[model samples]
Target: MNKIIEIVSSLDTNQVYAELSHPNSGGICVFFGAVREFTNNEQVTGLEFETYEAMALKEMNKLADTALEKWGLNKVVIKHAIGKKEVQEPVVVVGASSAHRSACFEACRFLIDTLKETIPIWKKEIFKNKSVWVSAHP
Candidate 1:
């Protein structure tokens, strides 16, 4: 398929390269959002992500379609993980493949930035002592 979009409990990077690889594509760009150990100097234990799956999936498909049309992308993948994620684990992955570097690069960035702005995913920062719900946009 030309597009892959899903909200998963776990993310697999091994499939990404193969998924985005196309004979006509001269360039592929990917962005991964991972959990960090600290946020604003506070020690973070992990993060929790929750989303309305149906809505999120629909929004993701829309974003992927837009990127594909706007950039003439050969392939596109948009995925996000839910539930608790430890530091260093990938929370989201966005990628694009096109005939040239610029299109894929630009599309990759647009897929991620637009996804953050439009998707209904919410994240909670897990601190050593407590958990705080951050903005839903991330």
Candidate 2:
């Protein structure tokens, strides 16, 4: 019954996973998104993430509520990093738990996909000499 909607400097994957564990849930799905070294075949050094923290968290919570209601999910946790992130560093973590595996998988997928599309977060692709502001929604 707990909803995890947070924006932090770093994402704690283990902690989010722990929060998703529930006796009523038989299946759990987790997703981790890391800063990649390449984008559209362009070499990348790192990434910088920024957000309207209050608005973003509110939107994230709404998504969690939607998932819970639609999928009968027992737990939904979404953690996003707001700051500079190096390559391979986790930027976002989403965990969903449901009584059935199908619901778990669908809810987890929906959480990540909907997050990227609807969240009010912005990102910058950091290159060797320049950085460009990018849209969080892909």
* lDDT tens per residue, model 2, 1-138: 578888999887768667998988899999999989899888899999989988998999999999999998899999999999999999999889988899999999999999999998988999988888886357
Rate residue 84 of model 2 by lDDT: 93
lDDT of 1 by residue, 1-138 (tens): 899998999999889999999999999999999999999999999999999999999999999999999999999999999999999999999999999999999999999999989899999999988999987357
Worst 10 residues of 1 by lDDT: 129-138
- The residue ranges of model 1 lying beyond 4 angstroms of the native Cα positions read 136-138
Q: Which residue segments of model 2 deviate by more than 4 Å?
A: 136-138
- TM-score per candidate, chains pooled: 0.96, 0.94
Name the lDDT value of residue 123 in candidate 2.
88
Question: Once model 1 is optimally superposed onto the true structure by TM-score, how far is the C-alpha of residue 15 displaced, in angstroms?
Answer: 1.1
Model 1 misses residue 52 by how many Å? 0.3
Residue 33 alpha-carbon offset, candidate 2, angstroms: 0.5
Candidate 2 weakest lDDT stretch, 10 residues: 129-138
